[model samples]
Target: MTSLERVSISIEKRLLTRLEKLIKSSRYTNRSEFIRDMIRSKLVEQDWANERREVIGTITLIYDHHRRELSEKLTDIQHDHHDEVLASTHVHIAHDRCAEMIMVKGRVDRVRALADRLHREKGVLHAELSMSATGDSLR
Candidate 1:
């Protein structure tokens, strides 16, 4: 097991009260766990901001499947970046619309590029990229 270190810091009374309110609403059991998670989230954000950092993310897309050549173009784009494309799944949102979630891992720039390309496609109704880290540094 890893050793634990207890540290202390001071904050203004008003900020502490606000922190308590956030902790209660988020349902965190203790201040230490909540603070640790907040720190980790900030670290993940830092990693994403570094374009050279290797990261993992999911590109989710909603589109009209019947649009001419749209599905083929999307598939071809993924194939072009096959090394970064980990896996993908497609499901029907309705008779005419489909959703795709593509898991990717690579340099931050490449992942962002893939998402951007997918997002700008003609038939795509919406596209969002959920950023994440590989967890090598978080622990």
Candidate 2:
């Protein structure tokens, strides 16, 4: 286990009150834990901002399966970036609708490009990229 250090900072009364409220709403036992998680979230954001950093994330897409050649096109795109796509799962949502989640890991730029390519496809109704860390720096 890592050693723990206690530090103190001064803040305005209003901000402290808001922090306490946030702590209660978030179901955290105390302020320190909450602040630590907030700091970790910021770190993950910073990691993604570094273009050369290797990050892991998922791309979720919902689309119409009936669209001509859409599935083939998406497959081709994934194949084109085979090194980055770790795995993918497809689900049939309705008679004509489908949903897919793709796990990807690579440099920030390549992953973003993959997500953008999927998002710009004609039949895709929705596309979302969930950015995450590779866990190398989180420790």
Candidate 3:
């Protein structure tokens, strides 16, 4: 187990009150734990910012199922990045619309490229890439 270090920080009164309110609304019991998680979240963002870092994320897409060739085109893009794609799930959101959630783990550039390719397709109504990490760095 890693040892914990005791430290002190100074902040302006206004910032401290804002921090306390944020912690309470977020339901965190203590400042230390909340601060730790905030730091870890920043680290995950840093990992993604470095293009060569191996990261993990999900690409969520909402589209019209009836659109010509859209499904096939998205499939082709995933196939092209097969090494990054861990898995994908598709479901019918409505009679005419569908949603896809694809989990991918790879270099930041390749993953972003995959999201861009899927988003640029003619029929995709919405596309979002939720960036994440593999947990090694977090630990």
Q: After superposition, how far is residue 103 of candidate 2 from its true place, in Å?
A: 0.6
Give per-residue CA lDDT, model 1, range 1-139, as digits (tens): 8888999999999999999999999999899999999999998999999999999989999999899999999999999999899999999989999999999999999999999999899999999999889998698
Which candidate wins on TM-score?
3
Tell me the TM-score of each prediction against the true structure.
Answer: 0.94, 0.93, 0.96
Please list the C-alpha lDDT of all candidates, in the order they appear: 0.95, 0.94, 0.97
Residue 92 CA displacement from its true place in model 3, Å: 0.8
Among the numbered candidates, top lDDT falls to 3
- Tens-place lDDT per residue, model 3, 1-139, is 9999999999999999999999999999999999999999999999999999999999999999999989999999999999999999999999999999999999999999999999999999999999999998898
Give the per-residue lDDT of model 2 (tens digit) for 43-98.
89999999899999999999999999999999999999998899999999999999
The runs of at least 3 residues in candidate 2 whose Cα sits more than 4 Å from the true structure, single-residue gaps closed, are none
Q: Which RMSD does model 3 reach against the true structure?
A: 0.9
Candidate 2, residue 68: CA error in Å?
A: 1.3
Candidate 3, overall lDDT?
Answer: 0.97
